[model samples]
Target: MRRPRSPSFQVTPKGERLDSHFISSLSRPFYLLLAITTASLVAGVWRWQASPSMHGAIAFVMIWATLDLLFLLAALGVLYEKPQRRSEPRAWLDEELVLWVEGRPFRARASDGSRLGIGVDIGFSELDAATRQRALDLFHKAAIVTLRFADGKVLQARIENRQWGPRQQHLHLGLAYRFANIQDERYAVDLAFGDSARLQENLDRRHQGKSILGALAHIAVLAVIEGSKNLWWQLRNLWDLAYGAMGRTLRHGKTKELT
Candidate 1:
């Protein structure tokens, strides 16, 4: 007689994939660069228009507006592109143990003599006091967990407890702590609630006692740059509108489209 193969579940990456904090942290730098580039381009165009042989200020303004419109369209295209989907097959989950996987809820009980184990302790009691506390803290705050089993299979799951409350928290905490302390390369626990790089950067900032102050400065700078950009665009639009009206008036019932 042949042995039966264990049933496998599919693992999919889903829900809130982007780290907002990471994006927020970079906003200041992004706006600063944009402001510098826009200013440089405007200065260059103004200098060119100042030359006696070049087109008038109106034409220069129109040229800059055209460039701005093109840039906006390109940005929209990139922003609205379809998001890529990634998934892993043959990822097994013990439904009884996992409250939810990747934000989707499901329930299942382990079958008799099944090899599938969920949240089973590898060795939590053996860890030292400080390491144990760190693991506990990690689990308590964890929204996502990556688990590796003894057989070298990897499982990534999102934790959600709707009914069990503190019991559920304790269960997951024990499992996560145990897995985190595992020494073997084959079995591991990885928790992700925020971007790792951002977290490290924040830690570094805190060590230097500049985290809060730096964040406030970034927001202030971003606000000023963005406000200036918006005001410039509004003025440009008004000028273009007036220019169009003037051209139509001069042409006597004929109008030209500005590209």
Candidate 2:
């Protein structure tokens, strides 16, 4: 296996590092989309006003502009979301680790690691009901576990966090190592993070994104839901006022007849 590179970021000309620029980079495409949408919308409106016969063109442009605008706004929402406090850079890994929990052995894949902690993925369905319960119990007690790698390396760490989340069916286990000395700490760091090239690779992979159709659909749905809410309230208020006026008119007619 190639040695991991050190965790040093290649800074941009704007003096922004990877950690700080990640969010803004995600919004770049959204900004482009919104600009194109706005230009198209203005042209479409101008054409409609000049010809009045291009109703179809204007209608299509309007719908496209709405979806694009909403999607861009949704992207901005994520871009400006509060940042979470994090620890040291974790090197991504996918190697088998033999986890010893209370003398019992369980198989897991080491997913990522830092100097102080490592994350693993375990097959949730592979464990028996009793063992699954025991794993949960260990998490609550901050259980110390001994894990062995395929290369005969071993480490004793405390199970600091456990999350039973969806990943084609796997549970995430986070471990914080209990090092006895500096040597142990150095060994743990080298074993987990290597040189840190994997961490940078992971960051690069995040930038090579997939399709945005799902995001557009999601934002469109939210916009429709919010607009419908306001429409419903306005309609309800109008109905109440109209009903009250009719009732008052009927009472006035009855009083006139009696007089």
Top candidate on lDDT is: 2
Tens-place lDDT per residue, model 1, 1-259, is 2435866666874542332212123234434555565676676677776865655664666566545543443333333323221121112222233233344322223111111123332223445778556645555565765544334445554443212224232232212222222442233212221235644754575566547768656555554554445445545767999999988787854544341
Q: Candidate 2's error at 229, in angstroms?
A: 19
Clashes of each: 0, 3
- lDDT over C-alpha atoms for residue 194 of model 2: 66
Tell how far residue 48 is off in model 2, in angstroms: 13
Q: Each model's TM-score, in the order given? A: 0.20, 0.52
Q: Which residue runs of candidate 1 sit more than 4 Å off their true CA positions? A: 1-210, 253-259
lDDT of 1 at 204: 76
Q: What tens digits encode model 2's per-residue C-alpha lDDT throughout 46-69? A: 888887888987888798787676
